[model samples]
Target: MTDLRVGIGSLKLKNPVMTASGTAGYGAELAEFFDPSLLGALVMKGISLEPWQGNPPPRITETPCGMINSIGLQNVGLEMFLREKLPFARQWDVPVIANILGTSADEYVRLAAELDGAGVEGIELNVSCPNIKKGGISFGRDMAVFARLVGAVRKTVKSAALIVKLTPDAPVAEFARAAEESGADAVSLINSIPAMAIDVNTRRPLVKNVIGGLSGPAVKPIAVRMVYQASRAVRVPVIGMGGITEGRDAVEFMLAGAHAVAVGTAIFSDPMAPLKILDGIRAYMENHGIKRVSAITGSVRT
Candidate 1:
């Protein structure tokens, strides 16, 4: 059997397939479709100190190969997450990662403290949320702000692993370096680029939010390049996601130096995509006479 296990900092995953934040909701929501335990890990939606109602009107729009979203990070706050979501997730067999966001450093610190004892395997800091008009770009655009925010949260969370999610809009190498220097255990990259669509009839913005994060196939190449750049900049492991639809797509990310891969838009297309891709990866590894998934990470040559 192929050894699919890989490490994200000190945390080891059974395989390199994880559900991206927002797409999988909390772990419990996907349980109805398939066995949650079969997944390598499940990343929850971006949670805040308080519940958010999210943006107004149309939040998601379908594009040619992908989709644009302005969900606005709508989620139950940390308190309710701990009281309700985390407890339910604890019953699942796979590792659970909480994707968190806050308007300020203190809020991030406070949320981290609350989830520190919530039995999650790790915490993914949502530093790249472009939906919120106020603080969405605050932490992601500036290296100093990113470092300070991560540093504060690092001090607060004692147990859970910390993974900083980065935006593709910034200088990926510099931003990733800042995250590592500030005490991030690992980093996930390419959290959708800012994009907009026009309504031909109305001659107005397609989405009510005016701007949305573009994801899916259109963003895959960008995600791959950013992941490659980030992997070279930091020693911390990198988790990659963009428009992965099949096993080969996942392999491309792995070869680009992503320690693991997350499936975002593909999940909407195929609810069983993760399992299928996981199986395909194993078959490919065995066919190539490879024994472990680590053998492919950063193995791409010029």
Candidate 2:
């Protein structure tokens, strides 16, 4: 009975629950397990200007409460995504946010221009992927570069909402402020931390890439802090993600000033995690006599 609808700039979500990028490969793959309409939005995999083969084998490895991946923004190029994936995905009822990456500011601008006409709801600018050795995380590490990159993309995408996704490794408040100044409508945070694991018996790194991005329960606390700081730093909306597994976890992020929360690594553990979390949030609101989800946003105790 609680109103769960939330907004990210000009885009409105039915609820604050959305499938994170990379985890939900385009909405088509998860259609059988859950209805895409139930989600706030579906962010496609990180698409580039050209197709990428991604890193070599052993891209993913399991940790105690989290997982690491070096997927390297593997996906069909922007043209292919528009021609092959976007048409079909448009049939779904929920908003579709295209997640895109590029090697330079020009590439980001070009990709954003292309996606603006793709009939999707918005674009999530990927500035914090740790898998790629070059442009991914590097763009987010420096506030100046981050601002310039976002400003370039902002000039290109005339219609769609631009959401800049920031890295948790950086000073989130500073980065978020830069994103806002650069004309971002909203910002999502805490992609993943760079990490590596070793196989004791083989006495070698477990992953083929030797290093990867860590996601899941282990990163939740860091994410919350980043979101909280970011919320204060920017006047724009914030979408928080990192190791969110349950409705309570989602609530925590919202309390930390996230307008909406995204579920990433948790989907692998439970296929219906987002839906269940949505239900749990509604139930929590009802039990606590709270009339809406927005009322609880940023209400956490310091």
Residue-level lDDT of model 2, residues 29-145, one tens digit each, is 788798898999998888999998999988899998899898878898888898988887877899999998877777788889889976678899888643244534578887777
User: Over the full model, what C-alpha lDDT does candidate 2 score relative to the true structure?
Assistant: 0.87
lDDT of 1 by residue, 1-302 (tens): 78889888767799999999999888766787889888889889889988999998788898889888988889988888988888888777888899988877788888888787766789999886432435456588877778988999999888888999998878999999999999999999879788999889998787789999899998898899999999999999999999998999999998999999999888888888889889888988988999999899999996
lDDT of each: 0.88, 0.87
Residue 236: error of model 2 in Å? 0.7
Each candidate's TM vs. the true structure? 0.96, 0.96
**Could you list the CA RMSD of all candidates, in the order they appear?**
1.7, 1.8
Cα lDDT for residue 256, model 1?
A: 95
Off by over 4 Å in 1: 129-136
